[model samples]
Target: MRIGIPQGLLYFKNGRLWKRNLNALGIEVVTSPETTEGILSDGIRHSVCDLCLPVKAFFGHVLALKDNVDCLFIPRVIRVEPDAFLCPKFIGLPDMVRAAIRNLPRIIDTEFNIKEKPEAVFWQEVRRELKGDRKMLLRGEAEAISTNEILRCAQNDRKRRNDKIEKDHRLQKFSEHKLTVGIAGRPYLVLDNYLNKGVVRYMNRLGVSVVYQTPEKNYIIETMSMLPKWIYWSMGKEVVSSVRRMLEDESIDGIILIANAGCGPDSFMTELIDGTLPVHKKPYMSLSIDEHLSDAGLQTRIEAFVDMIERKFKYN
Candidate 1:
């Protein structure tokens, strides 16, 4: 059977896992294309104005895939980790899509909460949905998990190598023309070029090195310890910890915080980052994006931010 996966929300983070798992189960996976104006407009048309930008984009992706796929895989994700929970919207995403869009294919809206149950329970639910053999399901899940772990290890190793290279270069001499900027945001907003108006590419074009906040387990624990209360949202904790990590890095010249217009967690996380900026004495900019954000406007603001950092580096 062909199953469609929308390329939004947690898809940026877990798309690979889902695809691999389904593929090993002998299912054909059909993914929606990257975000484009047509996709965004279609999503906006079907979605309510109050919904966040990422959710709207998700709706668009579902529409794009509905015609071709046998069913859609919009799992109701609650808590992946033991300590952290996802946003409320994610828990209701399947319901939201069902209510907002009509004339759709069968939706495999399974509840995936690993925090409460074992991983085998989720796979059992999937097996029931697909009516697959138990042994095959077990094999597929084992392979998928092993493959994901291998990828994670390789990524961590690459990051360590890059970090070492960056440290060695810093000790040599600082480049006059280049500046490093840390970007903190949800993967949907930061990685989707169409949604963020190609901000990463624009920064690269301006001769600036861009660093993304990928928080490690130790970093998250240490950073959250400083706060009075815990960050309940999983993505929020990641963003806050990433911002803290960036602030502590001497090489990061400035920071750019990106969030969608109507995201609640983003608002709080940005505030927390803002509150700590004074202690670091770092220049930072927070950009709130929506369907109305203009490419020219975004580029202009980034140019100005880069110029200010260049001036500070040249003088001080």
Candidate 2:
């Protein structure tokens, strides 16, 4: 069967895993095209005004793939961590999509609440679909995890190589000095070039190495233990933990959190980080992105932040 997957929201982080796992089961995976103006327009037409750009983009992706695919895979992700849950919209995303769009392919929405056993939900839901292929499911899970790791390693290597090249070129001006900035946001906002308006590129051009909130798996797990028990949103907790980790790191000169306008979890995270970081005296900037946000204003704010960091730390 051909399964359609929307390339938005959690897809930025888990798309590879889903593709790998589905392909392992002899299923053809059809992904929606990257975000574009037409896709955004379609999404806006279908989605309510209050939904964030990423969610709206998700709707667009769904619409784009509904005609050709046999099934649509939009997981209802409840929680990934123990005692923490996902955003309400994320948990109810399948329902929202069903309500917003018209006729579509069969949606395969498996609820993934990893707060209990790691593979309990996977085994329970996947068993229903692939009743006779227990071995395939096991193999797919392993392969997906391994594939994701390989991709992440390759990305980090590429970032390192690019940073070295940029640093070598700027050596004469600053003697190999570069500011390290930690970026905190949802995976979609952090990774999507269109959604973030190439903010990472801007930071790299400004001679700063950008460290995302999601670090090595072990590092994130270890650092999360330091956070307060009340920050309960799964993604929010992770972002906030990353911010705290960056704040504790002496090499990180500043932090810029990109929050989506009207995102409750992001708003809460921004406020939590803003309140906590002041005690450490670290430079922190929070920028909100919405459909109304402009490229010029974003560039100005980023340039200003970079300038302040440079003047304060003498880093290039």
Candidate 3:
């Protein structure tokens, strides 16, 4: 069967595993095109203003595939990697998109447990759902998951390495170039184009170097564990550390957080950052994007933020 997968959200982080597992079962997948003005425009036309850019972009991808494929794979992240938190929107995106779309297709629900040794719980659940004889399901589950894990590990390693290289390249070129901008957001929002509206390129246009959280995944996750015990939220720890590191980096003059309108985690942490980072010699700003892709609005906000950065860097 031809399965449709939206290329935003968790797809960026989990595509390799999904592709391998689906292909093992002889299913073909169709993916939405990368994010562009057209998709953002459609999102603006179709989405309510209160939604965030990533969710709206998600809505656009669903609309794009409404008639184009047999099934749409929207996986609910009950949780990824056990204790690491995903935004609550992730848990309900499938149901939300299902309600919004006029047309619907079959969906593959993967409620797997990954923290319990090599995805044992997840594959057991997957095989149970796949409709095969007892023996066949067992064999398929064991083989498909093991293969998927190896591939995912290798690919993640490559990504981390490439991120390091990119960081090195940027530092070499911009060490003396002087302009700097701090970027704070969820990894998905900051790195995925279909989600963040190409803010990286826009930052480049403003003659700024990006200080992002991508290069510090392990460090961020590690430091997240250090947050006070009362704050049980996993994301808060990570965002706090990410912004703290950015503020301490002398090369970063300002920070920008692109937040989702309803994302509870970012909404709380970014406010703390906006209030306090300036005192630490790092100024910050946030632009929440949902469906409003009107160039006039985006450009104006960006221009104002850029002006703030310029003024601060020059005077302070």
Q: Provide TM-scores for the models.
A: 0.85, 0.79, 0.73
Comparison by lDDT, 1 against 2, better one:
1
Cα RMSD of all models vs. native, in order, equals 5.5, 6.7, 5.0
Residue-level lDDT tens digits of model 2 in 70-94? 7888888888667778888888999
Q: TM-score: which candidate is best?
A: 1
For model 3, how does the per-residue alpha-carbon lDDT over 78-133 read when each residue is reduced to its tens digit? 65556665666676777777666665766666654345444544544554454443
Q: Report the number of clashing residue pairs per model.
A: 0, 0, 5
Error of 1 at 121 (Å): 2.2
lDDT of 3: 0.63
Score candidate 2 by lDDT.
0.74
| Model 2 misplaced regions, further than 4 Å | 116-124, 130-177, 215-229, 314-316
Better of 2 and 3 by TM-score: 2
lDDT of each: 0.78, 0.74, 0.63
Where in model 1 is the C-alpha error above 4 Å?
132-177, 277-280
Candidate 3: list runs displaced more than 4 Å.
Answer: 20-26, 37-50, 112-120, 127-178, 192-198, 215-218, 225-236, 274-279, 295-301, 304-316
lDDT of 1: 0.78
